[model samples]
Target: MVNKVTVESLTYEQLAKVFDHAILKPEQTTQDVITGCELAKKYDAKSVCVKPCDVKQASDLLSGSRVLVGTVISFPHGNSPTAAKIAEALQTVADGAIELDVVLNIGHLKSGRVQACQDEIKAVIDACHAKNPDVVFKIIFENAYLTKEEIVQACQLSVAAGAHFVKTSTGFASSGATLDDIALMRANVPDHIEVKASGGIKTLDQVVDLLNQGATRCGSSGTDKILDEFKQRRGL
Candidate 1:
């Protein structure tokens, strides 16, 4: 669905339709997460994604609001073990995160440890589900490390492993989400799955472009700037 964004305040109907939104910083203090929630609440954002370390505070600040708490697991490198990743996801959720982003096993996947990578993803998903069956699972593939073929294969694998979304990057890779990567994921994912275009999505135009390419969500720290543009554009 094309995001019908305007400068006016967002609604539950509108927020559910929102896929692109803000992520908190690791260096930011608890006050920052509170501030982020206040700002996101003003727009009724779908979620305020923060690093795992901040999930507890963000969740507390955003409690009673419609916004969900998002946290990343395993992160950009994907060198962490399946057990460690599951543990991280468990900790994140226990800390009040409702949406989990797990990094795919890139080294394993690239080295033809296909089943290993798939099993890792599945384990994370299962563990997260066990904790909170309602928790949403986004599997980051760090797409810049992949070729087009790898991106497609990863998308299929993510779907097969029961991930809710196929994410592009951790925003720490050499490159972030690309139209090509989102397009590939959109094309390859099963009907039940979604695509989240993360990393390096700084501008409103870039976010719109990602949505056009079938990105259902976006993770970025530049959300304030984007909202500013939206306000300016709509003269609200």
Candidate 2:
């Protein structure tokens, strides 16, 4: 079992590394993306997960910052055809996104089409790596639609397909990441395969709780508030 990380014991840098700083709402304007990048730069977050269309602009704005640019593939829904997802992955990377949070084909997984799911993931991985071998790929399970056994299988497939992380949600799901689901993902994947918990994670305590449960990263739109709360609570 992974050892828990207490919030009070964490450094500011460690706390910063845990956030992806989501900016992916459908109605987010260009100004919103710019403001989001500014927040990411100010916090020195791990990345700013934006919509595919914002990849280029976000990358340009965050050019000299430590914050990497991330975009989604198949997005809130995982129903995009394999070829289309592959194409989207390629274009996003070319547009300058170095990290990708891909939604798994939930329909396929729920239908017990495990191989198909794995193949699709592999294809996207191949496409991303073809452009930048160092690109990070995090597979989104959207756990609200999955059973415990299905979650295990999805984790297995993600690892087998050479994904860098297994994410818990898209933030557009019926529910977001839970401590139980985070634990399940951590237990199933190897240490090298990181876990990213997203969706409904707004407060500092929630992020810390998920991290203690073995989440390596989190997706949240409230990066500034969360960090401020962390500092306030810690007297930093």
Output the worst ten-in-a-row residue range by lDDT, candidate 1.
6-15
Model 2 lDDT at residue 166: 99
Q: All candidates: CA RMSD in angstroms? A: 2.8, 1.0
- Number of colliding residue pairs in model 2: 0
Candidate models: Cα lDDT each:
0.79, 0.93
lDDT of 2 by residue, 79-195 (tens): 999999999999999999999999999989999999999999999998778778999999999999999999999999999999999999999989999999999999999999999
Per-candidate TM-score against the hidden true structure: 0.90, 0.98
Which ranges of candidate 1 are over 4 A from the true structure? 2-24
Give the alpha carbon lDDT tens digit for every residue of 57-158 in model 1: 888888898788888887758888777888888999999998888888898888877778888888888887887899988888998888888888888788
Cα lDDT of model 1 overall? Answer: 0.79
Give candidate 2 misplaced runs (Cα > 4 Å): 1-3
